[model samples]
Target: GLRVLDNLPAPSLPCEQDRLRDFMGRRERGELLIQKINKLQEKLLKKMQLSVSKDGFVHFGDTVMLLNPDSKSSVKNCPGACVRLTLAINLDEISIYSFKSLEAPCGVSAVESVDPVARNTFCILSVDGAPASEPIRFGQKFSLGTTGGASDRMLYLASDHKSFIRFAKKSHLQQVFLTDELSYLTCWQAAFLDPQLRLEHEGFPVP
Candidate 1:
């Protein structure tokens, strides 16, 4: 009735054979493994982030926004008016641009409502740069020009001594010196001040 082969029972029907059952089980396990791999791939893709290019430029994904870094001009009538540029980086691309104002004749202005001492102080604001529509105020101690009278128009800050943030003219650059280490808010202000400045000293690409 029952025949033994290789110390195991041999089934008459292929479906009833132990070898067939083992093959089927292996096929099922392979399918499950493949499904798990696909799920893991999808999860990793979702976790991926965007970043800027290594050339200090932004890809902007679909369309890129070209910014002129060497362009420097006087603030004109508004002594308090200052231009700010911000640079941001993502896992995929980098972004660079200047700030704009919502109101016409967008420029720096003194906060009259604040305090009298604060009146001399002004905010650097813009609409086009990163963290748009925010105010960038003077650091603790802002100095206009160089320490030894090297330049007059450029503004240098204590936060960054290597480069000047504000440039009034080609020959003259203003300098600003901060009283203390930069804070979160001031750091953001510094970002808007100049992307090149942030890149030179801040270490991060600029955002």
Candidate 2:
């Protein structure tokens, strides 16, 4: 009755087990790569010799910046899903650092900045169809919409600041983006998007 399994050679693993093992292997590899990239970025940060401010901002060199070392300033009233967000600025990109915050930090996430007075008009910027629920980052590159109807893009460098904004736009509409359109986020939403005004890019003038 017992064939000793010599004729069978070995009992090959099941297909599902093989698949699970492969998936785990890939996940481990992916995590290792992410860790390596993060370390490289850390080295780059040190080479630049950056310093953090008291309020917790890692900035300077004009082209790059980091806000809230491990991410901070929790959004108020998010109920069951509020998570901290990181504000990372690499040469050409000015984006919220959290992998998950893109959708969460949007809408009216920066509610505290709403004020009747002491308010300044900020132009919303986007790429392709993305909405501007983030800061204009003070020094972000922006160009006037051409008469032919071309939109601007962000390069996130102070040196790339546009000399002028488009003139064809009418008076009131120039500064305000309605809530209905994805073309831009409302001012209140923009404030919520940047409650701390991380884009103020201190040391640099409010251009």
Candidate 3:
């Protein structure tokens, strides 16, 4: 004899739905956290004006000048007699600008210069027109490859006309080879490159 048996429904755990909801909530929170972190990183970078170069150089704009220790001055006053101890070093010793407050050019995309045969050094300057000026000097001569190649003919420039002419004569190159590319470069790029070279020469991190 077969007895009729009713199938019982499977038991449902009440906590399962709560667990799913909790997991979804956590996932949403995680996404929001990631977005916040990204926004914070971007804000910090913009505030610092930090940029990295292809050659692994790090750059910050004119703000570096404000941090220069040499720019600080002390004032001494003694009963109506005041003396200002201007300990600021000449800008030339630290930067590449021919004059104070002079910056690089605006609206330029790229600038590069090379001096080959001695140490094989090359410099490339990029700018978006910031009000900062510094000169980049290579400690070593850069390679220009072959004589007939386009890279072999590099345009050289000095801070002044006399230096330009002197360099031209010393290199036995035509004066036409020298140009005023500096006029087209922005101040920030020049300053960044200037300090970069100095730091590189000192064996310091470029950033």
- The TM-score leader among the candidates is 2
Off by over 4 Å in 3: 1-29, 33-35, 42-66, 70-207
Q: Report, for every candidate in turn, its global Cα lDDT versus the true structure.
A: 0.29, 0.29, 0.29
Candidate 2 local lDDT, 1-207, one digit each (tens): 865655654655797799888878867775445554454344323322222244342122212221222223433443443253322222122133422111121111112211111111122333333333322334343221100011122121111112256221333122221122232221111122454765554323222
TM-score of 3: 0.19
Using TM-score as the yardstick, the better of models 2 and 3 is 2
- Per-model clash counts, in order, read 35, 2, 14
- TM-scores across all candidates? 0.18, 0.21, 0.19
Q: If the candidates were sorted by their TM-score against the true structure, best first, what order would they fall in?
A: 2, 3, 1
Residue 115 in model 3: lDDT: 18
User: Candidate 2: which stretches are off by over 4 Å?
Assistant: 1-13, 31-207
Candidate 1 matches the true fold with a TM-score of 0.18
- Which segments of candidate 1 are over 4 A away from where they belong? 1-19, 27-33, 45-195, 199-207
